[model samples]
Target: MSTFSLDTATVLAAGDASEHRVLIISLFVAFVLATLGITIWAGRQTKDATDFYAGGRSFTGFQNGLAISGDYMSAASFLGIAGAIALFGYDGFLYSIGFLVAWLIALLLVAEPLRNSGRFTMGDVLAFRMRQRPVRTAAGVSTIVVSIFYLLAQMAGAGALVALLLGISSEAGKIAIVILVGIVMILYVAIGGMKGTTWVQMIKAVLLIAGTLLITALVMFKFNWNISSLLGAAAENSGKGAAFLEPGLKYGVDSMTKIDFISLGLALVLGTAGLPHILIRFYTVPTARVARKSVNWAIGIIGGFYLMTIALGFGAAALLKQETIIESNAAGNTAAPLLAQEIGGGAGSAGGAILLAIISAVAFATILAVVAGLTLASSSSFAHDLYVNVIRKGNASEKEEVRAARWSTVGIGGAAIFLGVFARDLNVAFLVALAFAVAASANLPTILYSLFWKRFTTQGALWSIYGGLASSVLLVLFSPVVSGAPSAMFPGVDFQWFPLSNPGLISIPLGFLLGWVGTLVSKEQPNIDKYAELEVRSLTGTHAH
Candidate 1:
């Protein structure tokens, strides 16, 4: 799932792809070498738990904003969405809208308060006004679960992408790529820590945006810079013709599909705020105001990038043949690259190879940056929340905690690699949707209750996290994602009884209800004094740790 745009081995293995292969490999190596150099440099500066987990809380708003943009834009958004748009027209833009709108929740409500209250992880903010051990433990567990789901998705995608880029057809070669990605990401966290990860993310963000803007400009140029002409050409080129420009071609306007679309929307909009890796970005900045500023910068950058996806997607549809896109990758993930290949000057041309190489390289860099952030967040939760507070009763030294974090990086990375190799054939986008459902259900409700509701108890926080997690997992297991339909991971097994694929429609409400019920039924009184302090600090950043 390692933020890959396409499972392109089949594409590379297609007719006369030797030139494209060499160009992709050469550029990928150059980018990897440059990123490895940065990781080595950041390793020397990461000395303490604070430095490792939060980049010493020193990054400026704009810098962190760039990092956030890098982390948020995944291969799914870049490759998958663009491909979807190329194939399905307007239907693909829904994903872009969901991703961009999610940041609004983060910027307006979550960023400032999270920065004011949290010290290391989301658990810090959750356990801020509650019983320390139980609340922290629940938050830690939820964080790890969500992070692992995302990590596996990213790693699996990485394996597929690497196999394609390197033209490796064997399972062994794919596994090697998975392990290579795992090792690099583990080192990114264990060595460079957050500072290194942040720098990598910032660099990747710039390159990704530049590449996207360039391709978009190229797309418009193909149509003589006339918006209507591009639209008309795309509509005419798409096999669906007028139907392609309309919604419901891919997702459908049926009742069940409509509900599924709404559920997916809910998860995406709420999930970004709850994502541990994204939330941890706030800790990298120095103050609540800075966090707010970073998020604003992120929204602007992300919004523009998504808008460009329109040009990329439509450009692909207009310029390339649908049969050709399907031949390259049934998932349409290779649409952007193929589009680049054609727009640059067709397959064997120097310009085509160069443009295709740039896109592939940026895609790889995007994966590396994102996985490093995920590894750091998961490891931080393990060491800071579970090992320090729960196991050691908060008595562990800073050095011990940092050491534990580094070791946990290895553990988490290994698990991710193992899962990625096994799940390489799974749908990366579907897996990510599941992760979002879990995060939105498990983490978002707890954060909102913890930060805004005075009556929220430790028991309530625990209920919210566990309830959300359990329901999402259970629903996903029974849903079409795991069992029913030809696309399901286990299509032969028909245990799916749930009507919808996404669990957010059911699980998110259950989480909020459980929190309310757990709080009302509690015999213990609310901690008014602690709530007063948390309320003041969350709102005004007064006397914050």
Candidate 2:
């Protein structure tokens, strides 16, 4: 560890009256009550498994669009990206661009077909044209893995936010947040189902965008619209400076680090279109056309949010100063909140405090909304893909399936909470990238090939899912993330076998290649003519549903 003599004790000593504590607690309580109220309301009208899982398939395009944005822009986008920009300069903005560009993939390739064919989960699409057991089993496993990683990221972000806002230990804050999230999400999904989750997402998205834009405008006002000057000043003050702007050599390490950064970027961009939690949201819309339109709206909203993050990051770099930030041990992650206080005025300054409060509240809400969505996705996979299809022999009633789904939601939420509490300090951005990589590696190939490739066989889907998942997980285990190989968790390990921080560069292609090769080797072919016709109709909104 590089030693810096910034006294964290002194920084923590400079305390303000805990006036914000009450406000924060009140906000949390309000969110819980509101979510519960919505669940109760949705319960009275719940008609069947479809209503519980897909909001009765009556959501308008715009409403679904906002919900999609809400689901996509989790704590990772709002807090993680903003912090990354504040700390890393232009490199952070590059991440924003990568995230935004993924929507183009969603719009052009995944959205319409996905919405048209699937019912509750991606398995619906994959199994629509193939054997149910193999496809459902593969998709369910992928969904669980991806959801766990994504949940860990959100939980980590929530822990950091809670610690910063409430003046508590990160460990304690992490536990509190995990428990809070688990309870709220379980209730939301178990009671309100999809409708409750959609409304919650919509409300949280509005608050998040408004909060980010408001903070961004204030920061710009502080600089008087001098964008060039702001960049210059931030570059000069930033510890990394020009290196940060250009993404030089990954901390003067080596060519391997550079490759790792590039691989990570690719994973993030490609992974968004394939994430089960995100892909399932597309199916909630009424039509493929609606799905297409929603993508456009989500793109615009998300793009705007990311643009504001660039300002927030630059504002933190220029105004917060590295010495002060480091002294607090806040590093890149704390930049946004610290900058907010500075620009808004001071710790107790009304404008700054209020803005900080809103941002914190939204961050909390963002985690809740996302975990709710994730739990629902995982639960549906268990109920629709696994339970009803396999154990129940596809003979279960809709009510029975819905009940199983509710119970599954509780089980998944509990597991995530347990993991989040244990793995509290893992980097949120890193976990998110891993989640994306796994999804792209394990899930995307099967879905895409089964839909578009004529030679896709059930054996191929099974081989691809297992092979891709194994490759990604194994590569990640050996990656710098776990072993401190290339980048030592501590200074003396020096055991890196591969240079890239992320495994997607290799794992994604390995997945696709394995699937194709498996198809060639398998003699059996799927009779998917009718399935393909249905998919085309779904994509074109000619389905008679």
Candidate 3:
């Protein structure tokens, strides 16, 4: 490691707090007002369950693609990954690749079949050939758990991010920010429904992509249009020197760390296709062809954005010192903003204030778009899979189901806000990792088998969902995140027994294994006729549902 004086790092000076606050608040108000207006328009048009849950199947391929980008690129991607790259160098770039590559799974396997079969939620597809109640119940549980876990991280990050951006020192202010986000997200789903949510996501995607492009272009200009020089300077300023440009700094070359890296890779690559929020995006389009086209469009946009992140991350490392970034926020969550302030003009300049405000407001919009998607997925699963089909014996009217979904949105949103206040100290990336592990473990295998397998039984589907969900949760509870040493979440308690923080390596295989074993041991005969019908429909997009 290179010996560099931490105290010598240049600190970006702060401008007038009142000015920054005014700019940020004004931009945020404009975004919220626009989305709320869309919600009102969508609400007036939403007359039944189909419109509320799937935007009346009206979104085009390009429109759904923008919405997908908005829902997928969360604050974690904008802030957390950029910060990691600033602090850890090459390892952070790996995250971008993992996130982008996962679209292949979505495109090649899940998207077409899912759109061809599922109507409202993921359970609709999984339970198509299997016994409805038990399978739907299992899928519903997994959907809720994954969505809530993911939502908690976004909500907590919102609170912390707003507090940092606005210079709000009080804990109460942070809680207020969390509640505000939760309430707005709830309204987006409960009132505007999926049409409103899709429009918000599309608008947010445009703003986010534009903001990232502007920042990246400025960073490139600062380097005088030389990549080699930029990398060299980033190495020199990183204090770790050349090692910062290589791997093994963030995740070392040890055996367990290697396994941890693989586990994380599995979750990231396989998990995107399994996410209920993303899966629901396909239902917004009217045709399987449109759904496939949406994924293709999403791949182009998402891939390009990740490339920009690579630039932004290295830009922060080269232009700003490590110590300065840590001092702003230990987790480096504020690195992107600090970079925005620097490249626009040194801090306190008019250019700096304006650029910082634009990026901050975009980040706030990112959180809202993602949380709304998750809330819709979770509440729709509860209302459609459990309440209407399971409890009411599929006798409930469309209006009743829509009413149940609205109430479920409020309940889930409230729970997320409550949990977020207490979990404000948790790492955003770590929470995201747990959500991914559960999605990959519990949902991916079932979806794949349901779509392709001829002998997949109801028992197998239920076993896979419950087993994968259980293994992921149990392993996380015993992993380093819960307890290990002073830096762990439960520092006072040392109950960590698992070697790795992520459980995808073990849980994913176990999930597939249980599904296989459950199929082999089942006495119930496979319904060949149903399988034939599902296969024909899934392949040809005819008579779906």
Candidate 4:
């Protein structure tokens, strides 16, 4: 079940690797301290609800753009997608395509309207034209569920990535790393608030882009800047010949596999627009125009980064043996770092150690920044939508609401840590794909309907949120990811009956269907006046919060 094979005694016994371990540890410690300092600095500027939840709406387009990229280019992007390409060949690059194309949906449909309509969380926009209590409650629940799923992937990635680099092969070591990540993320959300978290994300984004750029350059140099050469070598080294460079190696093998590929594609492409953490990021900017710019910048930056992943993935496949990559981490989460080590100068070289340390630190920073954003989004929903808007009927003071959000951060962080330990062996990309499916299913329907549909009612919002949430999670519970397969979280169990590992194809349409049905059947009438006001506000930022 463990991806890491280096235990404490083993590290001590391997005298040469000890130096590499020391270097990695030092870089990790430095990144952590540097990010903490940034958080502490930003925390002082966080004074009230607006500051805590939305960074006082102070960031410019490019700045918030980096933060958004930081949040989006997570372990799934860096580790998971790269690993998928390394292991599955052409099928894996599909993730890169899906993820990059996802931003178009965000830019065209989500970013501006969301920024103009909502003050803080997604619940704000969803509840704008509906019964506040019921809609806010449902939106809050949906947000937390989606955010937690996303958080679990980041935490699981953190555990596997860190343990793989530090040479801690024990299960306990991985669990401990998860706990440490949760604790750090809690501090980022609770103390630094949105401002601190944004700053950390921005810094992490720069580091991640730099690290990836360096590796990509090295990879291209190794292949003499020829894409053809790299692909040929990868195909040869993958042990599957030309098949490795083509489809069906991973997702095109059977009817079920094809459907699963489509499901995963739907999740990755449609999921970005609905992701709670990514949604909340728009609030950090000043205006709807700025939000659009943020998305544009993010698209360019993220697109470039993913394009580099082609080199990273293929380079790893070309250089490292498939069996060794699997032995490093069956999910291939460690392939990026191993590639860095190799390109720097194989295994025992000083250059390899330095490069590994740098790359691992960048990835660790990626994990920390993403988990912070997710924790912030879920906790903000718990406090802003559920506690303040629903339970207190908007009677709570800003200070009290902020306190509730901090507490919620601690609670959600703990849950993520607990869940991450169980999920450490799972593919981070696959786990995140589930989160995307849930978000697309539960949140996206309500959001699009609320913004564009004149007949969208409170009942429709409720049905879409709850129905989508329930079906997605339930389907995943019975899917191959949780049981009935060798890679299942519980490999010994076999209760899975769902065919697709990802629920996007089924759940996403169901969410949209349920919303339309609920609206038609409900007695509650749609509010024309509120819808008009919402439209004006969403389109022009007229009297927006």
lDDT per model vs. reference: 0.85, 0.74, 0.85, 0.85
* Per-residue lDDT of model 2, residues 1-545, tens digit only: 00111111221222252656677667767877886887789877788988988888888888888998889887656655665666667656777888898888888888887777678888887887778887898889988888887776666555555654566755665578667767777888888888888888888899889888888888788778878777877887887757767764233367776677667776777788888888878877777777788888899998898888878888888887777765554435456667767787778787666656666687788878887788888888999999999788699999899999989988888887787776665433445656888777878888788767867888888888888888777776666655563333332454556656688899988889888888889888667785567557655766524
By descending TM-score, how would the candidates be arranged? 1, 3, 4, 2
Residue 35, model 2: lDDT of: 68
**Tens digits of per-residue lDDT for model 1, 1-545:** 21223344442333345677787787778877788789889889888888999999999999999999999897767888888889889888788888888999998889999888888899999887889999989999999998898888778777777787776878888888889889988988898889999999999999999999999999999889998888789989987888888889867868898888888888889888899999999999888888889999999999999999999989999999999888777768888888888899987788888888888788888888888889999999999999999999999999999999999999999999988888887665456777788899989999999889999998898888999999999998888877877767677889999988888999999989999999999886888888888889989988765
How many collisions between residues are there in candidate 4? 1
| Residue-level lDDT tens digits of model 3 in 163-188 | 75667768788789788888998999
TM-score of predicted structure 4 = 0.94
TM-score of each: 0.97, 0.91, 0.95, 0.94
Which residue runs does candidate 3 get wrong by more than 4 Å?
1-16
Candidate 1: regions farther than 4 A off:
1-17
Model 4 agreement with the true structure over 1-545: per-residue lDDT tens digits: 01112111211221245668788788889988988998999889889999999999999999999999998887556876777889998988888888888999999998999999999999999989899999999988888887886777678767766776677778888789878878999999999999999999999999999999999999999999999999999999999999998889888888889988888788878888999999999999888888998999999999999899899999999999998878766767667878888898877888888887787678778879989999999999999999999999999999999999999999988899888888776644445556788889989999999999989999898899898888888898899877898877678989999978888899999999999999999998899999999999999999989
- Maximum-TM-score candidate: 1
Ten contiguous residues with the weakest lDDT in model 3:
1-10
Error of 1 at 284 (Å): 0.9
| After superposition, candidate 2 runs with Cα above 4 Å error | 1-19, 167-177, 239-253, 329-331, 425-430, 485-496
